[model samples]
Target: MDSNDFAKFLSRISSTPLRVLDTSIPNSKYIYLDLSYDNSNLEKIDASSSESLSRFVNSHIKLHHALVAFGGYNEIRSIYQRSNHFNINQETERNVHLGIDLWCGTNTPIYAPIDARVHSFKNNKNHGDYGPTIILKHVIKDVLFYTLYGHLSMDSILNLKVGQFFKKGDCIARLGDSDVNGDYPPHLHFQIIKDIESYTGDYPGVCSKNDLDFYLKNCPDPNLILKLA
Candidate 1:
């Protein structure tokens, strides 16, 4: 996909504000938010309880550890390996996170930060997967790349076409419900991609610990554009 055109595309749509969610509700059960997203000790987990179980999986499974989490434009993903389903991408041998997850309530408005063309999209219905997803191609300084917005409402894809052009800051998708968005608390999963590697709606949001080198190289820190933390 052409990324340079995408950079030029983002240049025109600067009217919209990017957003992060206030997930700290009375019963949010997220005690650690007060500390930091990169807290290493929080991940020391016990299988008997659900608290921080997601952290245990995310932290240990991936050797790189949390660089900068939560509030930032850092790509995020929800929980996995709570059970024994092979279809569900678990953090077993692979680090197993493909995109950035933004914590918030359901139907949180998800907007485009840069201009892009619809590279591909799909509704991947596997458990713990992106229920409804979209991928876009963008370019900056003649550099070709792409971004992925997953766990989005299925309705967002309606009337969307492969070649459809979207301006930056446009309302493109909404944070989907658990029933529609991989059965986790509502959030937005975003990722930056240097190359699509022939996948369409389905990209490897999760990667094996062995493959972190390649993924990190191709997937630059999204914070470059999304400084939302």
Candidate 2:
């Protein structure tokens, strides 16, 4: 987790796996597909206007099936504190993404990707926030680290124990519905952390442009494992 080593490590793992699929799929079939789609009824996203990014998935036929499959994570820029923060019962403004979003569709099975123990779990109910979530601890090559899986169904944590172990690629949870999942769409926000820093089920998945340097250090690109960077 040496912030300096992030570039070296992530670059190496980015192209390693090369693909994602259903971890539970024994055949590893249907691993690759064009992910663009539009007007999908999976959630509340209505692609009434073709200009919307939401329609990018539907309007463009070339990217028909490239939804987030089970392989690894896709990178996206995010910000912390850039969005207005307020006290509970108060309102806040816009936010930016900080973690790599695995675009596998809703109810897609999410696996551990590594053998790790459940560090903590929580159901963050904020709009646009991670719905049911679980954070697991891992140590690769003696470097202690953890991964946070957000936007999961509540059942994912049903028998999950704080110290229980999940083998890599073991199905641990399913993508959840909009009611439980944050408002936008269903996807998993997977993050890698060198340290949890006393944070529970929640971590600043979004950071401001100013604080990005600090967050980029704490939360390196998860493609270090997915190798899809």
Candidate 3:
């Protein structure tokens, strides 16, 4: 099915509420982060440094977490420049982010949105990569899909095994620190995939401008299930 049809299917099947964060906390705010190329705020801070990212989040009072819009074409030049995995070449870079990032603190609990089983898990130990990641396989109304939880702590995968199941709202994992989470600030990179193809614990959460159409088709807007942004 196409993106629109897939979205409609997801909406229809998502009868249960999914909480990736502690929304029960009063006075906590979710700030929308504009990392797109046109966002001038990107000029004020060092996008590559985790320390800089931490300070940016703390600047706002009671800001428990920050939210990034999915399918955003971000101007994350510094972070991607360090790794060939993202840079690809001097001409074409993977600057467009496909996942929705929920910027929060380390050890913040992440819950499963629906009944799912561990499809794959691995520590992607590389600069600008998803440090410790987990992919959960799920099926709803006979439509099989997968959800990726990136930038997770080492402990999150310690006891996990392929086919291990988790119910909705179960604490599946926790956010990792910058050092272990691909050297970036603590956050959960969540993505929804209609088909994983042959990828294992790793998948392209960002894509080059030339490959945007293909990636967009394979990975739809995560908000269809998240319903947060």
Candidate 4:
């Protein structure tokens, strides 16, 4: 299926919104966060410091009376400059985020939004990487797609195996801290992939401007499933 058709298929997966976080946490408790370079407020803080970013994220949640601060699909960020993993140079810098991040506390349980089987799992140990990641294969109406969960706890993948089945709402993993989550504040990097290509446990969560169009098509806005306002 084409990207447009794939997005429509995802939208019709369920009559109600999907839940990757706790089901009890109402959608009203989720707030939109702008970490883009355009947010001048970020200039005052050290974006490279995990502690600083954590403080910023937590405070935003508290200030908004929210349980989760989420956004960043297609957002252009400058925080990636802290690690060469995201930026080799100006032209090749992959600063545009391709996923929606749910900023919450570490150890927060993450759930499978729908029925799926483990396709792959890996510990991406590079600086500013996903840390522990899991990709799940989902086939609904015979249209195959994948969902990626990134920045998870070590124990999340300790005994996980490929092809393991998980029913919808199953506890798949928990959020990881800065120590194990690529030195960033605790957050779930959730993405949807139409064509996974040869990618395994990890896929490009961010893309350079030159590749934005292609990546956007392959990885549709995760909100198509989450439906977070």
Candidate 5:
């Protein structure tokens, strides 16, 4: 199905709002992050380290949590530079992030938005990788889709099993510390996929400019359900 059709399908299924984070506190804010090449702020500090990133977020923004819009074509030079994982060759680099990232404290609760079955789970133990990742499959009105929760804590996937069921608003996992969560600050890399396409446990959350069309079509804007930023 096309993106418009997929979005409609998602809206139908998501009648109730999904609480990916704790909603108890007041004054909780969502700050939009700009990692695009033209943003001059990126040049001031290093984004690769958790400490530097945290300071950057806390210093500039008063919000408790930071929110990033999905499908943002970013120029995350520090993180993607000199890495074979992101830059395959001189011509192309996977700098455009495809997922909506929610930056918050470690051990924060993460919930399943709808009833879903665990499709796969794994610990991607690589630098700049999704430390503990889980993919859940959901079906609504004869349409199937998947949700990916990356950068999770090790404890979150300790007893997880394939085909495990989770009800809507279920606390399936918690945010991970920087050491285990791809060496980045604590955050949840949430994404929606119409088709997994042979990928299990992990998928490319970023793509090069040349392949932007394919990835954009494959991964719809996660904000259709998030509705935050």
Candidate 6:
């Protein structure tokens, strides 16, 4: 199937929203967060500092009476400027986020929203990168795809093996703190990939404007399944 068809298939998989976090945490508790350059509120804090960003995010959550701050799919963010990994050049800055980030406290349990088998797992230790990551392969109605979980604790992949199976709602991992999560505040970077190419354990979570069109289609908005609204 094509990208558009795949996205429709994903949305039709479950009428109700799926959960990668605790099923007990209702969707009402998830507040949308905007870290885009257009958000004037970010100027008040040091976006480069993990601690400062954490405080800003937490405050937003508390202000809305929310337990989680979630957003960033296809968002053009300025926080990425602090990392050279994303700003290798001026014209090709990888600032457009490809995943839906769920910002919450560390050690929060992460679950598999659908039946899957481990495709790969790795600890990407680069600054401002996904620290511990796991990619799971899924096939439904004979269409194959993958889901990526990033910023996971070290323990999440210690005993993990390729091809290990996980039923829906199985505890897959826990959130990692900045110490291990690429110097960012605790958050889960969840992405859905229709075609992962030959990548293993890691895929570009952000893309430049020059490549946004391709990335957007290959990595459709994860909310198609999560349906956070």
What is residue 28's positional error in candidate 1, in angstroms? Answer: 19
Off by over 4 Å in 4: none
- Taking all chains together, the TM-score of candidate 2 against the true structure is 0.71
- Of 5 and 6, the candidate ahead on TM-score is 6
Can you write out model 5's per-residue Cα lDDT over 4-102, one digit (the tens) per residue?
899777766655546577654322356666656667886787866678877775554554343422224233434666357676676786787887777
Name the lDDT value of residue 18 in candidate 3.
Answer: 55
Clashing pairs in 5: none
- Minimal lDDT window, size 10, model 3: 66-75
Query: Lowest summed lDDT over 10 consecutive residues: which window, candidate 6?
Result: 1-10
Q: For model 3, how does the per-residue alpha-carbon lDDT over 63-83 read when each residue is reduced to its tens digit?
A: 434342122323343456657
Question: Per-residue lDDT of 1-229 in model 2, one digit per residue for the tens?
Answer: 4687854664564344522236433323223323222213323433322124234433332353333432222222222122233112223322335566655456878877767888999888876578799998876667677788888887877777888787776778888866687653456778877778989888877654455567778887665556552
Per-residue error for 36 in candidate 3, Å, reads 1.7
Please give the RMSD of candidate 3 to the true structure. Answer: 2.8
Off by over 4 Å in 1: 1-78, 83-92, 96-98
In each prediction, how many residue pairs overlap at the backbone (N, C-alpha, C within less than 3 A)?
16, 21, 0, 0, 0, 0
In candidate 3, which residue pairs get closer than 3 Å at backbone N, Cα or C atoms, i.e. clash?
A: none
CA RMSD of all predictions: 8.1, 6.4, 2.8, 0.7, 2.7, 0.6
The Cα local distance difference test for each model comes to 0.59, 0.60, 0.78, 0.95, 0.77, 0.96
For model 1, residues 106-139, the per-residue Cα lDDT tens digits are 6777776677788988998877677899988876
Error of 2 at 107 (Å): 1.4
| Poorest lDDT segment (10 consecutive residues) of candidate 2 | 74-83
lDDT for 66 in candidate 3 is: 31
**Over 4 Å off, model 2:** 6-15, 18-65, 69-94
Better of 2 and 3 by lDDT: 3
In model 4, the Cα lDDT at residue 145 comes to: 88
